[model samples]
Target: MIEGPMGAKPEELDELCELVGKVFNWQMRENFPTLFCNDNTDNLRIIKEDGKIVSHFGFVIRDMIINGCRISVGNVGAVCTDENYRKKGYAWKILDQAIEKYRADGVDMFLVSGSRSLYIQHGCTHVGKVKNYAIYRGMPIPSAKVKAIKYTVDDLPVWSALYRNEPIRFHRPYNDFLVLTTSGLVYRPDSRLFSISDGNKIVAYVVGSCDNNKKSFGLHEYAGSRKAIIASIPQWFEELNVDRCVVPVNLYDIEFNQIFHSLGIEPDYGTTGGTIVIINFPQMCERLLPLFEEKIGSHIANVLTFSERDGNYVIGLDGDEAIISDPHDLARIIFGDPPILEAPTKIPAEGKLLDVIKAIFPIPRPEYGLSYI
Candidate 1:
C-alpha cells in the first residue's frame, strides 16, 4: 500500500536520513544541516510505502536580493528514491507537491541541484550566462599585494559583513552561515576558505577547492573587491602549489569580466551550476519591477504585463508582446540564455521587446558555495 506525499514528521527523520544516506552515500544530516535539521522537517517532503520511508525531496527556502529587490528561492536537494521504488513516479509526486506547497509560500523560483530529465520535463532549465576563466601556472598575473590567510571560525562576523556587500546575494542569516561553513559541505569536499586583507583591513575572501591531484584550484565563491581578489590569485596558486586556477564570472558582474578582458583572457560561456524553475513567474517578475524600471526605464516597465494561461507564459509591453509556450524557453529568456544554449526564438531577436529583455534579463544569481544544499 502507498501512503504520503506529505511532510516528514520529526519521528520519521532518522529513517529519512538513513534512506537518503544509502541513496546518495553521504550524511544528509551532517553535510546539509540547514536543510535536514528538525527546523526544516516540514520542508523534507517524503513518501511512505506501508509505514517505511521510500522517497524524499528536500529544500531550503532562501531569500535573495537582486539589485535590492527580494526574490525568494527554494534550493532543492537531497532528492532520492529507494532502489526498489525507482520508476514508480514517487519522486515526481513528491516534487510536484513540494513545488505547489512552496509556490504558495512565496517561493519565486527553485534552484535544483540536479539536471535530470525529470526536472526538464517539469519546466526546469539551465538558465543564466556565466564565463569561465582559467589561469595557468606562471600566467603573468600581478603579484599579490594583499595578505591571504586561511579562514578561521572567529572570522565569521567579518566574513558575513563582506558577503552582505554583494549587490546580488542570499540573505544568509548568521546562524545558517555558521552552520554551513563549519559543516564542511561546500560544493567540493576539499574546499577551503581564504581571507584576503590589505594591510590588516579585510578587503575580500574566496572559497576554493583543489582537484584530487592538487594541480588545479576551483574558485567557487568570492566576495568583496574584485581587484583585491584578482591580485591574490597568484599568491593562492603559489601557496597551494596548484598549476591552474578557475574562476566563474556571472554575466552581470561587469567589473570582474572587464578586469579579465583587459588581461586578454577570453572566457568560455556556461550556465550556473544547476537547473532552475520559476515557481511563480508573475510574482517573481513583479518583485523585480524596481530592477526592470531601473534598467529599461519606468515607462517601458510600467507598461509591461506578465501573464500565464494553460502553462504558456506571455510577456508584453504596450502593443508588442512575446508569447512563450515552453516554460523552459521562458526560463532561458527571463534568466538570460547562455550563448551555448538555444535562444528564445519565440521572442523577437531585435525590437522593443528584445531590447527590453536584453536590458533587464539574466538577473544576477549568487554562486551557491556555502549555501549549496
Candidate 2:
C-alpha cells in the first residue's frame, strides 16, 4: 500500500522510483533517484509508508540577488504523490514541512513551479508577468555588431556582471553556472548557453533550452545590452529553425515588450509561471524598504514598515497598521499586481494611498522561472 510523504529511508528509493516512474513516464525507470536528485541529495525529502514510497517533495536552497543583496530562496521541485494517495493530504503535509524547513534554514522566500492555486491556498502568490510566445519563420532580427560565442568558464564573471545589471535575479556562482551550462536542468537536455561579444568585450548573452522533441522551445534567460540581445534574437531563432519558439520575458522588460509589440508579435501577459511564498515578512519588508521608498517616495515609502503581531503580518504606516488578511494578497500589492487599494487599515498603501503606491511600484521587475525556463 502507498503511504504519504511523511516518513522515509534509503531502502525506500526503489519503491519511490516505481511510484514516480509510473506517474511521470518521462524516464525508463532505470535512472531513478540520480535524475531526481539532480546530483545532490543532501536536501532531498520524501515520505513513505509501510516500507514503500508514496509521496515525495524536494527543494534546493539558492541565493537570489535582490537589489544587490543575496536573499536566500528555497526552490521547490520534484513534487509528486502516488496516484492512489492523491486525496490523502500527503502533499499538503509535505508542503508544510517544506515551509518550515525553508523558514528555519533562513530562506527569505520560497518558489514553487506549476499550479498557482495549489500553492496560493498555502499563503503563496503568483508573481511577475511573463510572455510566452512563438517565434515564426520570419521573425524580425536586429542588426548585431557582436558575434555569438559558446559560453566558457572564463567568461563567468562577464556573465555575472550582465546578470547583475537587473536588480532581481538568481545568483549563479561559477560552479552553478558550470553545472547548468553543461547539463542544464536534469529534465531538459537540449539547453544551450552562448555570449555575444563586440570586439574584445562580451556585450550580451542568452541561455535557452528547446526540447529535442521540438514540442517545447523557449528562451530562458538573457543579459547584456538591450540592443545586443535584440540583435541576436533573430539569428538565434533562425539557427534553431523550430516550427515555433516560445520565449518568456519579464513584464517589466520595456525594451523587449516594445520590440515585440512593434513587430506585431503580441505577448501573452501573465504572472503564472511560478508561485512565491514569503517566509519572513518583516525581513522582506526591511530589505525592500529602500527600494519601495525609492519608487513610491519618502512620504509613502517612509511609512512602509512591516511587523507581525499575534501571528498575523501587518503593514504599518506611521502609527496606523493594517493586518494583511492574506499573505498572498499582500504579495500581490507589493509586487505591483492590479487593484492596489484595500479598506483602510494600518497598511502603507491603503484606501486612497493605493493611487500613490501604484504609480511608484508600477511595472515591478520581479521574475520567476529564472532558475530555468
Candidate 3:
C-alpha cells in the first residue's frame, strides 16, 4: 500500500469512481464521465493502496467576501475512504496533510459539511445555530408563479451573484458552478438543476433530487430573493411533485422567517448549520481589521488585534482586554449568533469591545453558495 495525491487521470478517475461507488454506493464515472475535466485539480489529494485508490480528501479554494472584502476560503469536501481501508488511519493521515497544505496556501478559513470529531482534532470547531424552514404541500400553495428554465454556461455570473446574495458567501467561478450543477448525477442520476425565472429575469434556482421512497424532493441549494424563492414554490410542486421544501434562514435571508411565520411555517431551531475551521487567526484579523475600523470606528478597531495561544483562538487588544473564544464561538460570533457571544465568556459581553466586534463581524449564518448540501 502506498500513499500519494492522485491526479484526475483516466485510470485514476476510474479508480476514484470505483472506490467512491463501493463506499458511498454511487456510479460516479458513468453518471459524470467528465467530472474533473474542467475543475481545478491542484488540491485533489488522495491515498492509494495496492495500485488502487483507497482514501481521498480534497479542498477547493474559493474567493469569499466577508464584510465587502475579498478573502480566500478553503472548502473541504469529497472526503471518503475505501471501506476496506477504514479504521487504518488513512483518513486521519490524509486530513492532516490537507490542513498543512491549506495553511501554506494562504487560506484564511475552512468550511465543511460534516464529520465534527475528526475536524475538531485538527483545531477546527463546529459552530452556528441557524433556523430551518419547511413548506408543506398543503400550505395554501403560494400564488407566486416561478418559471423554471435550464441554465447555460453563459448564465454563470447571474447565478454567482444570486448565490452570493448573503453577507458571507464563497465567490464561485464559472467552472466551479458548472461542476456543482452537474456533479450530482455522479451521485444520483435523476437530479435536476434550473433557474427559477420571473418573466425574463431569473429570480431563484434550485438544485436537488427526489426521494421516491418518501415522495420528497431534497433541495441541495437554493438562492435568490425571498419573493423570488417564495414565488418559485409552484414550480417545485408541479415539476417535482414535491410536497415539501426545506430551506435555511440564511438562504432566504431575514425575510424568510417573518414571511413564513405568517403562513404557519415556523423555524426549527435545533440545527447547528455547518462546521468552520479557521486556518489562520492573525491573517483573518488582518483581513477583517479594515471592516472593523469602518464599522466599529477607529477608536476600537485601531487597538484591537487577533492572535492565538496553544490551540485556543481569540481577538482583542493588549493586556487583559482580550476576548477569549474558541473557533466555534468565534464562528458563531462572526455570524452574529447572539447567544454564543452573549453567553458566559471571559470577554466583556456588553461593552465598547463587544460592540466593536459585533459591528464588523455581524453577519447572518454564512452561506456556501450554489454547491451547498
Alpha carbon lDDT of residue 303, candidate 1? 87
Write the residue-wise lDDT of candidate 3 on 129-205 in tens digits: 56777777767645665577876666667787887675666676656666665543524566667787778888777
Please give the range of 10 consecutive residues that has the lowest summed lDDT in model 1. 341-350
Off-target runs (Cα >4 Å) in candidate 2 are 1-22, 27-42, 84-86, 116-118, 131-140, 151-157, 210-217, 243-247, 257-266, 296-303, 338-370
Tell me the tens digit of each residue's lDDT in model 1 across 32-129.
88998888899899999988999998989989898899999999999999998889999999888888999899899999998999888888988776
Candidate 2 structure quality by residue, lDDT tens digits, 214-246:
644577777877677666656666576665666
Which residues of candidate 1, in runs, are more than 4 Å off? 342-345, 348-351
Output the lDDT of residue 319, model 3: 44
Better of 1 and 2 by TM-score: 1
Candidate 2 differs from the real structure by a C-alpha RMSD in angstroms, to one decimal, of 4.8
Better of 1 and 2 by lDDT: 1
- Model 2 accuracy (lDDT, Cα): 0.64
How does candidate 3 fare on TM-score? 0.80
TM-score of each: 0.95, 0.77, 0.80
lDDT of 2 at 293: 67
Worst 10 residues of 2 by lDDT: 338-347
Instruction: Provide the lDDT at 121 for model 2.
Output: 85
Enumerate residue pairs that collide in model 1.
Answer: none
